[model samples]
Target: MLYEKLLAPLLFRLDAETAHNGALGLLRRANSRPWLQALLAGRDRAPEPRLEQTLCGMRFRNPIGLAAGFDKNGIAAPALAALGFGFITVGSVTPRDGQPGNPRPRLFRDVPNRALWNRLGFNNRGADTLAGVLERQPGLPVPLGISLGKALQTPIDDAFGDYAYSLEKLHPYADFFEICISSPNTLNLRELQEGSRLDNLLTGLVKKADDLARSAGMARRKPLWPKFAPDMPPILRDIALTKCRELLDPAIDAVVMGNTTIDPAFNPDPAKGGYSGPPLFPKARDQVRGAAARLEGRLPLVGNGGIFDGGDAYTMMKESGCPLVQLHSALPYRGPMIARRMVEELLQAMDRNGVRHVSEITISQPSRSSK
Candidate 1:
């Protein structure tokens, strides 16, 4: 209530990126205090048994995860984790240091539509810096995944090498790695999602990640899920999924079916960046539905994009037959209590549908077959 009535409006008055930095800075201070996390979480709530799921060896208290860009360099992940998120994915970090992203005013908001537009091209403190943060920070309660991307200046041909550097550096910290080849903000990064290029990238990274985990004598190889763009053409989406399926062994464990969408159709402003929030819900859900059909239950797909509530969460999982879902753009609008609200409403949604466990969820609506 305080957030919606006051803090949000106050923050919205500032520049989008500035508001984000101020909010994150507050969470960073909260990270050191247990009570602060509890208060920010809205309550000392217990995990609802109905929402818990174990995917890729990680136990998720709920299907709602904070998407990658929100906690880019891992600044406030621990505090965010305490806010009832099932998981927290940090980074989209590049291998090289000081990759100053695109110029200012990179993040924009559309309050009336409940959406955001951004071209903040993989901006971060780099993999090494994130590695230090993870090493020094306390471990989170929920599963933590690191999103890996190529340095903006790196040649697309050597993309895997860039991802490999981050993989090796952050391997010990991440329970999973999200290969982000789909962010529209990065130059030519999405090309890595094309046929043979995707195949080589996943295959090579899979082998490299395994080698790292083995050398370090870790309990097991970390899971890797490619974060894709929501606007990928159906043909390219299928090709990417096929390559992922082929490399399932000691490779691609799950898939984050999308990042933000760059489709002009969703953005009324004709902005030169991806669009996220409610407007993207339908397209992103359909994308996962298609991917789910193509994979034929062989691999798990993490349904992501435009999820602002438990109804959307339920819809994402049920309509797409995906076990999990993630959200980012909803945060500013929904406030810090977003995850908790989503969880409670998700339970309400589950009760209404007579559904018990989230894993037992399946596609409920007639879906278009992948083209």
Candidate 2:
């Protein structure tokens, strides 16, 4: 309540990126203290067993997760987990040897729409640093998904090597992996979503994942989920689905339906990057629904985008047929308590809809498909 009414407003007055860093810094500090953790935990609502879900071979205490791009370096994973998220996906970490990102003023707020636009360009401490962080941190209370991407200057042809390199470094640390082929800020990155390109990339990545798992003595690879864009054309989306079916190994677990939106309707500013928040909800739901239909339960989908409340979360679950859902923009607007609230709402929605399990609600309803 304090965050929504006061702290967030004051934070909003600052530059978006600056405020983001400040908030994260505070969370990191709070993470070091037992009392603060207890205090925050005390404020949270008791966990609801009905909200728990098992997806992609991992058990999520709740369906709600933190989307990628918030903790781009994996520095705050333990703290974010302590905040009551079922899971936390940190990083769109690049395989680059060094840290590189966009210039300042890369993030902007659309307050009325409760959205944000950013062209941060996969800024992080690089894959090696992220690996080290993961090694040093205490194991989280919930599952963790790591998002992978190519470096800014890496050519599209070389992007596969980049993604694979990051995977090699971070796979041991991730319960699931997200191949980010959809962020609009990277040059030609969206090409990975195209038919031939997507097929080639997944084929190579899947092979590498298998080799890594075998070498590590694991029975199989971790979940490999591709995070897509909401604005992908129907033909491109179809291509992506076909490629996922044909090229992805059985070890590949799910698809995260959406990274952010490149749609002009969401960002009228021609120069702005991908937009996210409430304005993105309807389109995101449509994409998830389409992917769910196309995949036909072959792969689980992680629904994300414009989820602001429990009703919004439930709508995404029912409409898209996604077993797991994630949140990002809402945290800033509603604070950590929002996670607890969302869980409550999701359970209530489940009861009202007569769905016995959260996974059952995903893609359960037939609607106008996007592709």
lDDT of 1 by residue, 1-371 (tens): 88889889999999999999998998898888888877776775865887776667778788888999888899888899888888999998998573878998899998988999898988899999999899999988899999998888889998888999999989889989999999988889999989788988998988897799899997667888988888998888988887877776422288789788878777665464888899998899889989988877777788998888999999888887888889999999878899989988988999999998786795222222331
Kindly give the stretch of ten consecutive residues in candidate 2 with the minimal lDDT sum.
Answer: 362-371
- Runs in model 1 lying further than 4 Å from the true structure: 250-252, 362-371
lDDT of 2 by residue, 153-225 (tens): 7889888889899999987899988899888888889888886788888888888999999999998887788
TM agreement with the true structure for every prediction:
0.95, 0.93
Output the lDDT of residue 338, model 1: 90
lDDT of each: 0.85, 0.80
Which candidate number has the best TM-score? 1
> Which candidate number would show the highest lDDT if scored against the true structure?
1
